[model samples]
Target: MKNIRNFCIIAHIDHGKSTLADRLLDYTGSVTDREKQDQLLDSMDLERERGITIKSHAIQMDFEYKGEKFILNLIDTPGHVDFSYEVSRSIAACEGALLIVDAAQSIQAQTISNLYLALENDLEIIPVLNKVDLPSANPEEVTDDIVELLGCAPEDVIHASGKTGFGVDNILAAVIERIPAPVGNVDEPLQALVFDSVYNPFRGVETYFRVINGEIKKGQKIKFVATDKSYFADEVGTLKLNQVIKQSVKAGDVGYLITGIKDAREVKVGDTITDSANPTINPIDGFEDVKPMVFAGIYPVDTDEFEELRSSMEKLQLNDASLVFAPESSAALGFGFRCGFLGMLHMEIIQERLEREFNMTVITTVPNVSYYAFTRKDPDTPVIVNNPTDLPDPSSIDRVEEPYIKATIITKSDFVGNVMSLCIEKRGQITNQTYLTPERVELSFDMPLAEIVFDFYDRLKTVSKGYASFDYTPIGMRTSKLVRVDILLNAQPVDALSALIHADNAVHIGKKMCEKLKELIPRQQFDIPIQAAIGAKIISRETTKALRKDVTAKCYGGDISRKRKLLEKQKKGKKRMRQVGNVEVPQEAFMAVLKLND
Candidate 1:
């Protein structure tokens, strides 16, 4: 146990975390010459293409220092704020973290947030400055920033270039010297923390865990404490370039377990795995359930495939434990599942994964935040309204409360005014402001969660010219004057296109929704009236003109009265068609509501 070092890498997005990880693996001789590649720990194709780490990857490395062999378990984590939950889980399973900061960009919002997370867990922090090879890199300035942020000595900061593998040996030495090893009793009952899991079509679910006490052996009966389900361990192994099968994995080791449990729901991440016969007294602590910030509906393109979509979601949930969902039905979109996501990026990644991995094409409705609605009769009991259609009648409602978030933004001083105006336009109130440096500023704001759900992040990037980094944490709900805006096609309300908005911007948003839908919805044989309404009052309207067929073309050179009669007949036919014909709301129209500001 003294020679074992378990740690993870945490950083802001595009801060050279993965690149530094690759150099570490190469120096430790964990991979062969053929296996060498950039971003080696990022195994998913989507991750490589987007240059982001969507999942946390764990791998074992072996090294020898001064005639003594050492075992290193490195877990690479995502840098995006949406996957902070993943970082938390990874931190729980490790004793230390490598806090990587980009020398050129200095410290950003996500860096500060992730650093706080590590500090809360009491993990040993080793500050490393990466990307020193770039011409724009400012190692001296960033080193000073790290010293101020971490309160460490000047020489304590390590200068490294992931591209050139500089200072890789020093990082390894620091891990062995600074980070503590796992401390547990091998004689104690089995107590393992399951940090992650994945599904396999051929075998079953594979769970990756860290053994805190006792040991797990192949063919032994193991049980998940959360689910209280037991199964025989078909295989036990350590995570590497390829899974290394082992007869047994003892305490203070990181490994994988296959129980042949075909059902994905059986294995829960953050659950305790124990020996069925001699179980541990209690489960691990500090693993809190994920709080979803955005709610949206996901439905199959074909209604009959609802069951298939359900199964796909179950398998996906096994891989991504942060995703929460329940069955729901919509009048216009039929049966679907209301999914809770961390944020818009998290929601978009899940949708993309559903299409790429499962071969399931789906339609996602307008994303919204969960709201609390109270009625006059039941003023004390608040109804959770995740969808706009779930809101109670306007007459019976007492008041509605919406979730708020404490947003932290770090940007250059030049864009401070632009960023502040953008936040104020989103109904945000400035809470605090501080200068991290003469040219860099950190701004804090209290904003409604619903306000930033659509385009706030994108606009922030735009206004800051990609120099700003943003992070947010949910605050308690506050009462707000909100109203539900319903989109109607030919005077019939479409539940799928409806959204709850603040009363002040209801008319403006309603007008935008109407005009956007007019351009998206195709022209039919009869005119389709697109209306945005708040209850009986229509706030805005747009008309998609009908496709006309010239019935008078066949009667060319005929009497003017004859042409007029033919035109009147066509108008009457259009009116009759408008009454009986149903408007087919294209999929694009449902998504168009999100791009109202465009």
Candidate 2:
């Protein structure tokens, strides 16, 4: 335990944290001679395809320094600001963090935010400037920035190119020399904090954590602090310290425990596992129960796969603690589940995983923000509405408030003015600004969470030419003029196409939404009018350009069977759609405009 070192790799998105993680595994001989992979920590297909780390991953490796064995617990956290909650949880499981900065780009908005989180937790931070092989690499400037921002000594910075394995040994050496050893009592009663967990088909639930202050072995009885439930430890599998071998783990060492637990709901993140005989104190703080902010209804294109979707979600919920769901009944969409997520990215990742991993195609409804309303005679009433049809009557409410966030954007100084104007146009108020470097600036604003949920970040990058970065934290909620916009296929309203938009932008946004829907829904058998309506008023309308050929001219006598088959197929397909007068609206037609700008 005296030689144990636990730390997380912190960096901005695309700053090469996963690349560096792969390099460290190689440096420590954790990678076998027969197997070599790129970005090994990004195990999910969606993560590799999207080029972003969505979840926190941990692995154990052993490093030899001066002929002495040192155990290194490498924890890789998501770099995006939306997943900061996951980052916080990962950071809590470690004793220190390696602050990885891009030498060519210097510090970013996420760099400051993650560094501040580490500082607040009093975790030891070792600054390292990566991508030193780039022609534009400026290690000296990046080192200075680190010193000025983190108050660390400039001489402590390590220059490395994770892609080429240059200066990586220096990173390992610094890890042993600079990072403090884990400190805790090993001989006391068993106590372990479950920082993370994964479900295995064979082994059941595997709960991983640091043994803070006691010795735990197979066959010992333990208890969880939060649930107060006790269970017998089936086995204490040999723990991995990166590539090193460990027969037994003591206090302050990282390890995993396998038990009779099969349900993920039983073992939770941030829960303390302690010996039944004698337990230690629960050092859980700075951790809050994760509540989902954005919600959407996920159903299948084929109703036959409904059971498959349910099972897949159950399996996914094992690894993702932020996902929440409850049975949903829709008059138009039929039975489905109301799924909750941390943010839009989190929601998308789950949907993609369902298709890629589980092989089930799904149709998702428009995402909506949870709202709270108060009347002149009543107090605030909490309501969760994803469909516009569920919106409360405007006259029955005295005030309505939407969640707001305090955001910080870092970008090149050349586009600062444009970013500021974009923020203002999105209902944002400037609070502060800072010159990060001669060519870089940080702008802070208070904006509605709904305003930035969809494509705000993408637009920010588009306007700034991919040089802009952002970070946001919830501030609270404020009253706003919110209106519900419904879409009618011909005249009857389609509940799935409803949205809550600010009153001021309704008309212009309604027009853009209708235009987008016209492009998404394929040209129907008959021309379909896509209209955006508020009550009896139609503000915008567009049509799917008329169908070229509805019926084949060669289906008459001998091909009567084939023609009957084709007509039967079309009838079954039309059963999945909603009809309003003469128009047949495809399911995608209703789901298309939800992500119009996305």
Candidate 3:
């Protein structure tokens, strides 16, 4: 146990976390030369293509220091704010963390947020400055920033270049000397914290856990405390580049356990694993349930495949425990699930994964944040409104409280005005501002969660020329003047197009929605009137003109009575078609609502 070191890498996006992890792996001789690759721990193809880490991956490394062998368990975590929950879970399973910051970018919003998470867990922090070899790297300036932020000596900061493997040895030596090993007694009852799990089609679900007490042996009868389900361990192994079979994994170590449990729900992340004969008294603490920031409906393109989509989501949820969902049905989209995501990026990734991995074509409705609605009859109890169509009638609604978030944005001082303007336009109130350096500034704002759901991030990047880094945390619910806007087609309400928006912007947004729909919805035999309404009042309207047939052209040079008769006959046919014709909304129209700002 004294020679075991368990730690994770945490940083802001594109701060060389994965690259530094690769350096550590190579320095420890964990991978062969043939297996060497960039962002090696990022196993997902989507992660590699986008040059980002989406999943938190764990692997073990063996290092020899001064002729003494040491075991190192390194968990690589995603840097994006959307995956902050993943970082939190990873932090819970480790005793220490490597706080990597880009020398060029200094400290950004996500870096500060992730640092706070590590500090809250009481993990040992090791500051490292990465990418020092780049021409733009200012190691001295970043080192000072680290000293002020972490309150550590200037010399304690390790300057490293992941590209050239400069300070990799120093990092390894610091881990062994600074970070404490797992403290547990082997004689105690087995207690392992399940940090993560993945679904295997052939082997059932594979659970990765950190053993805090006692030891687990191959083929031991184990039980998950949360689910109270027992199963024989089919396999026990350590997570390496490949799984290394072990006869026993003792206390103060991280490993994998397979119980051949085919059902994904049987193995829950953050649950406790203990010996069935002598179970632990309590489950692990400090691990909280994930809070999703965005809510959106995900329905199958084909209605009949509802069951298949459900199964796919279950399997996907096993891999991504942060994803929360429940069965929901839409009037226009039919049977589907209302999924809660961490952010827009997380939502988009899930949608793409469903298509690529499960071959499930799905339609995602306009994403919105959960709101609390209080009705006149039930003023004390608030109704949770995740879908706009679920909102009660306007007359009955006493008050509506929307979720607000504390946004932290770090950017260059030159773009401060632009960033401030964008936030204010989104109904954001400036809370604080500080100049980290003469040229770098950090701005804080209190903004409604719904305001930033659409295009805030993209617009912020554009305004700041991609120099800004944004991170947010839900503050709480605040009462707001919000109205539900419903889009109607030919006097019929389309529930899927309804949205809950602030009353001040409702009219303008309604007009935009009506105009956008006009361009996307194709013309029919009869006029299709598109209306945006709030309660019983119509706020905006647009019409797609009918595709008229020239009945008079066919009766050229004929008598005026003959032409009139033909026109009347055409009008009657059109009226009949209008009564029976159903508007087939193209798939593009559902997606168009999301890009209304474009």
Q: What is the C-alpha RMSD of each candidate to the true structure, in Å?
A: 1.0, 5.3, 1.2
Candidate 1 worst ten-residue window by lDDT: 589-598
Q: Judge candidate 2 at residue 58 and give its lDDT.
A: 84
In lDDT terms, which candidate is top?
1
Candidate 3 runs further than 4 Å off: none
User: Candidate 3's residue-wise lDDT over 470-580, tens digit each?
Assistant: 999889999999999999997888888899999999999999999999999989989999999999999999999999888888777958999999989989998898878
Each candidate structure's TM-score, on Cα atoms with residue i matched to residue i, is 0.99, 0.89, 0.98
lDDT of candidates 1 onward, in order: 0.94, 0.80, 0.93
lDDT of 2 at 544: 72
For model 1, residues 1-598, the per-residue Cα lDDT tens digits are: 8889999999999999999999999999999999999999998889999999999999999999888999999999999999999999999999999999999999999999999999999999999999999999999999999999999998999899899999999999999999998999889999999999999898889999999999999999998999998899899999998999999998999999998888888888999999999999988884789999999999999999999999999999999999999999999889999999999999999999999989999999999999999999999899999999999999999999999999999999999999999999999999999999998999999999999999999999999999999999988999999999999999899999999999999999999999999998889999899999999999999999988887977997968999999889989988898899899878788788777778
Candidate no. 2 TM-score = 0.89
Candidate 1's TM-score reads 0.99
List residue ranges in candidate 2 displaced over 4 A: 238-248, 277-286, 303-308, 379-387, 522-527, 543-591, 594-598
TM-score of model 3 vs. true structure: 0.98
Candidate 2 lDDT over 1-598, as tens digits, reads 7788999999998898999999999989988966668878877787888889988888888789999998898889989876777788777778899999999988988988998888888888888899999999988888888899878778788888889999899899998888888778877777677777777878788777778787777778888878788888776743443323344557877777888687656877788888877776654453677777677888777777777788778777767777888777665666778898877778778888888878988778878777666766675565545556676776676777888989999999999989999999899999999897888898999999888867788789898998998887788878898888887765667676788889999988889888877777666655577898876789999887655444545676675778778777766555444352255446566556545666
Cα-based lDDT at residue 413, candidate 1: 99
Q: Point out the worst 10-residue segment of candidate 3 by lDDT.
A: 585-594
